[model samples]
Target: MRRLIAVALAVVLLVAGCTRNSDGAADVQVGGDPGASPTLRFRAPLTVTEPSSTVVWAGTGSALVEGKPVLIDYWLENAETGAVVAESYTTSPKPYLLTKESLGTDLFAALRGQRVGARIVEVSPASAARGMTFPTVIVMDVLATRAEGDPVPARPGMPIVTLAADGAPTITPTTTTPPTDLTVVPLIKGTGDQVPTGAEVTIQYTEVDWATGAVVDSTWSTGLPVSFSLAGLGAWSQGLVEQTVGSQVMVVVPPSFGLGGPAGSELQSATLVFVVDILAATKPTAPVSPPVTIAPSTAPSSSPTS
Candidate 1:
């Protein structure tokens, strides 16, 4: 299993390096019948008819994937080796939040809106293709793509805020401030990062009911971060992305928390104060890759009148 994972990940890095962006995330490289170079391949067996964002490959003019935040089922096969690389099958689409580039789980990688259904076979064990080592072929399929996300903006650096889930405490931002409520204190001031559209984050906070003038739920998260997303998540954590992570937060929620258990159901609405630590944080920033442009096509014709 590890062997397959290693090979698949290697091919992905190779494929990514061979590709670059032009103009920005707005304009990406796509398919065209142009001069072939040792650096790139103009043809791809798998393709996307239409592209969503600037995040597209330069190889084929067609879209390789779809949706802003895409999820895919990917598989890698050795082009020459004829080996199956890796496999991931789940109902919920594994988002290919392929920001600038991905971090971990290289073996199972995907672009937005497209999933490599199954990575089957490996051709090049480490041979140079166009001077770069790339698996001759990779097998993938798109599982799902839509206008859904974790509800975070495209930001980097700083901290991020991810909402909570059911059986857990619920928090909401009030239109006005409550004097008897807790206030978050930030060490520094920055715009903050963007949480993955569907990331579960833990928070340490305090909650005080205005009516009681007493601290109610002033406890930290027992579990890792609560799982939530802007795409599929409901009720809780809906509008959290509006605020930046690392910054202090003041919110209101029910006094009782389920903690994933049946007990602790004292539902009371009050302003909760928190200094949230956005796990897997991201900040708004620009892509580092340079933009590219293709030679413009020209028509040739001439006529003489006598």
Candidate 2:
């Protein structure tokens, strides 16, 4: 996972014979189709005296908002040698919480006002504290973090779900009796890869109680998605195994399907409803242990147990 860039003060020294545009961006050429690896053309030994960012292409999608999750594909290269350092285009796009605390000042500024599908280039000077002797350039493509897919009509008896302007979901349970079996319904059908069992899944979810129609927990409140192995979350493991990325799903879990807690617990007999947005799913490279279970309280454990 990509982490926040470390910030440290360094003396800014101008490099001789380097050209910069009006925006302070390096005079480099960027060419590529959207959603593909960008081609960069620049003189070797390129250097920048200060950090600069330029949007190579503006997106036609929705504007990026702060305190929300953003997905991005990035390519980092050494501007001095034209050597590729790290990239996400060959792998999967990474997710980040769009906050200054999570993305650091420079990165946050670069992505702050941009919209989804925008491609941005950031140039940074060398910093000894960061172990960089040569300047680096990073190209980033912002992707939609929310579910974007074909809307699917939900089952008649399932709870009603509504979305806020920011894509946070609200669940309203009906007066109808809860189902006795585990039920999975896709509220939105995505075009991405299907999630396999035991895959590490990233999702934004809201959990509601069926009987009281009260919300028990939500990831939107925290402004970050959660990623975990779907091994022991009984209903989640069963229902989400074949779900695709960028999809939104509604799951009805009876107490027998788990997530209500151990026997004799307060919610052990309760029926649970979940509205989940599937962000990303990747198979683990190594064996993963089941996550620890927390003691049940007024709210159930975020990681449901078998």
Candidate 3:
């Protein structure tokens, strides 16, 4: 298990993206929006090949566009063999969705400037840490894009404070949401290696954006005595939580929280790597039972010992 986690970490560090499957759709985590993915004025050397490569022209990509929202539909397949690995198709179909300004992630930056039904793109130089760079190929399809002022979808897992957009609360409505936060730490010495859900744990952590290698937040739990709820709940509330409490994990909280997007305008995903030690455990008290005493039979004193 530790080995698998270590490998996963290696993959994340090299790939520069986060992946999540939602309702048969994949949310490919990308870097911050820099102003509409750079218009591919020229082809990039460090890139991946997508199915749309042939149909598209050779041009440089755009950084996400500021203010304007980018709406798109994507499909991922092996570039070399056309084998489908992931796709984002909605049976109901909600057309024209923009990349929210408030959120941050890698996709925003990489996918900017790309218009809907425009064409697919490929990226190479398989990030330094992506050990298995030879994954055949990746294909993405762009359906359409919309300018800013378009209605943005309300993302989940964030608190919606009824305040003005401005921090003043009363003057300009603001929603006090948690900043994009995450930590990757190593457990201290003598700290049990396993991260059980019900055990108290400790570790040292550093945080980085899932979309970019930029450090936005970091926190440590050195020798700190803490208990577990086993579900990693109430933990993310405190900045750090183990999905399995012991297993190393990558936690991503995208933009939409008001925090500066990854690399400006790009969506943000906080990826965490945890090496926790069980320091203590919370358990119910055991019940106490009375002890019983035993008596031996007497033989009439044996007549004064003869």
Candidate 4:
């Protein structure tokens, strides 16, 4: 079991995006709004003598840059079998950091210069995609692109916040004493949509123990933001509510509201400091009707994990 898990993880990390499909490309047809999820239809036995891609719809939003996190809704079909291989339209769109190492070869090739809100159709021959016997047809909708949010002014008495060129934050302790009350500081003021309670939010954060000034954890080290719903994050939800996406914030939580326990226990007593950058916010999408369970794809993909 452990070996199987490890192999699966290796596959996910190293080859999630392989070829578009296994066989020769067949006829590919796509129709839908560029801003929303589009429809994918293609005849079986599609033949792609060579790899091909087309932008069915062009969005007016910002163009996507390589190495940035991107959110997308997608559908994959096996042209030979006429099957829905893997899809996110029935569930939720997935987020992927747009790097060659993380995306499938064909997907990365197809989306390099596309703008947010574009709909793309791509066909990959079996020769290009691995582990397939038929050509694959893929349709994708680019939803949003992650950006380094606006820069905010400094606040006195809070931890000093500085950013690397890529938006990762370096937090330094300014004072030895921890605050007794909750302190919310907006380090970078963003212009994006306000984050609502229970919405899924993507953020890069570093946490430290206030009393000892020791680092607890951080997402900055990985260079990828983590996303979660704010429903049960306790003080996190309180501090982040009403903050706009792309804002960098400093949240100081007392034990009672932050960790929840006696006031003096080592774990509960120490004030916690979190330096967070709100990169994006999305609400839970309504589920599509008559949900379809598509078979997992042979192609490598980095769509959002359920």
Q: Global lDDT for candidate 4?
A: 0.60
TM-score of each: 0.27, 0.74, 0.23, 0.63
Please give the distance, in angstroms, between residue 122's alpha carbon in candidate 1 and its true position after superposition.
12
What does candidate 4 score on TM?
0.63
Model with the higher lDDT, candidate 2 or 4 = 2
Prediction RMSDs, each to the true structure: 19.8, 6.9, 25.7, 9.2
C-alpha lDDT of residue 168 in model 1 = 26
lDDT of 4 by residue, 76-165 (tens): 666567676665564445556676656755567667888876776665555422555566666667764334456667777777767665
Residue pairs clashing in model 2 are none
Question: How well does candidate 3 score on lDDT at residue 85?
Answer: 37
- Give lDDT: candidate 4, residue 255: 67
Which residues of candidate 4, in runs, are more than 4 Å off?
Answer: 1-50, 55-99, 111-120, 125-147, 211-213, 258-267, 286-306
Give the worst 10-residue stretch by lDDT in candidate 4. Answer: 1-10
Evaluated with lDDT, which candidate comes out highest? 2
Candidate 3 at residue 214, lDDT? Answer: 47
Q: Write the per-residue lDDT of candidate 3 for residues 164-273, one digit (tens) a residue.
A: 22111111111344344542222112211233333222222233343344444332211112222333333333333222222222233334332333455443333322
Q: What tens-digit string does per-residue lDDT give for candidate 2 at 1-306? A: 223132211211122123456544356667778766788777777756777677777887789888787777677777789888776554345667777766767778878889988987776778786567778877788877678789998688778988898788888888898889988989998777899888777677889899887888887786666666787667778878999888999988888765777778778889998888887676665312221111111212555666
Ranking by lDDT: 2, 4, 1, 3
lDDT of 4 at 233: 68
Query: Could you give candidate 1's per-residue lDDT for residues 158-245 as a string of tens digits?
Result: 1233344311233333334454322233332334444444433223343444344344443333221221233443212432454444
